[model samples]
Target: MKKTFEVSDRLFELYHRVHRLVNESMTEEGVSLARSKFLFFLSKLGPCRSTDIACALNFAPRTVTEAIDGLERDRLVMRKPDPEDRRAKIVSITETGRVVLEAAEHPRKQLLEEIFSALDDEELDALFDIVGKLVDRTDEIRKRKDEAEEAAQIAIAR
Candidate 1:
């Protein structure tokens, strides 16, 4: 019998390949994939606490902190005290960061186009639909897990 793989196994392989290609392409911008992620998140979220970035990215606190340190050093992001919380610092993207982000987008677009060029429009549409469904399923799973954790905590407290 011919070896067969589950869709999830094939999807994981595809994820690794795409992630490797993206990281390799991002290096041309003089920023690692991780740093680019932090820059983009700061751009979207505006000034926010470092912990918030860590949570949003689902990255370890140390990882986010180290990336932020490099970003701050490169002047792509700046740290300031949060107005609402004196003890917390917020990170915001700088003008340099905006320029870097804009410069990065064109090449990223080209890379994605090259990667996806093998698929026809119909195939691409089907792939998108499946990916969207997977994302929704993951979100649902996360919600259930969160609710279970919260209920457990409440039960323990009582």
Candidate 2:
């Protein structure tokens, strides 16, 4: 019997393939996939706290810290104490980071275009719409789970 594949299975495989492609494309910049993502986020959001970065990026705090450390070492980002919260630090992209991010934009766009070149405009639109709905639902579920966990912790503390 011929094995059949589900849409989810295909999507999972495609995700990994795209991820690998991106990572490979980024090699010349000496930026890891994770750090590149963080740089993009910082470029979009401007200065932000590490906690915010972790939450927004859905990355662990340690992961964010490590990425920040690497970026800082590369002079791509800088960390400074938050004025309102002494305990928290704010991270901002450096000039070099901005330059790197700008340089990366075209190639990243090309890579994405190449990967999805098989899909025509209508197919791409439909795929994006369906994926957007799935992403929204996933975010909703995650938010509910986080709220429930927080409530449980509060109840326990009380």
| Highest lDDT scorer | 2
**For each candidate, what TM-score against the reference?**
0.86, 0.82
Worst 10 residues of 1 by lDDT: 1-10
Q: After superposition, how far is residue 102 of candidate 1 from its true place, in Å?
A: 1.9
Clashing pairs for model 1 are none
After superposing candidate 1 on the true structure, give the runs of residues whose Cα lies further than 4 Å from its correct spot: 1-5
- lDDT of model 2 at position 137: 92
Error of 2 at 98 (Å): 0.9
lDDT of 1 by residue, 1-158 (tens): 23335766787898889878877777787666667888888888788889999999899998888888888999999999989999989899999998888777677778899989999999999999988988999999999999999999999999
lDDT of each: 0.86, 0.87
Question: What are the per-residue Cα lDDT tens digits for candidate 2 across 59-80?
Answer: 9999889889989999999999
Model 1 whole-model lDDT (C-alpha atoms): 0.86
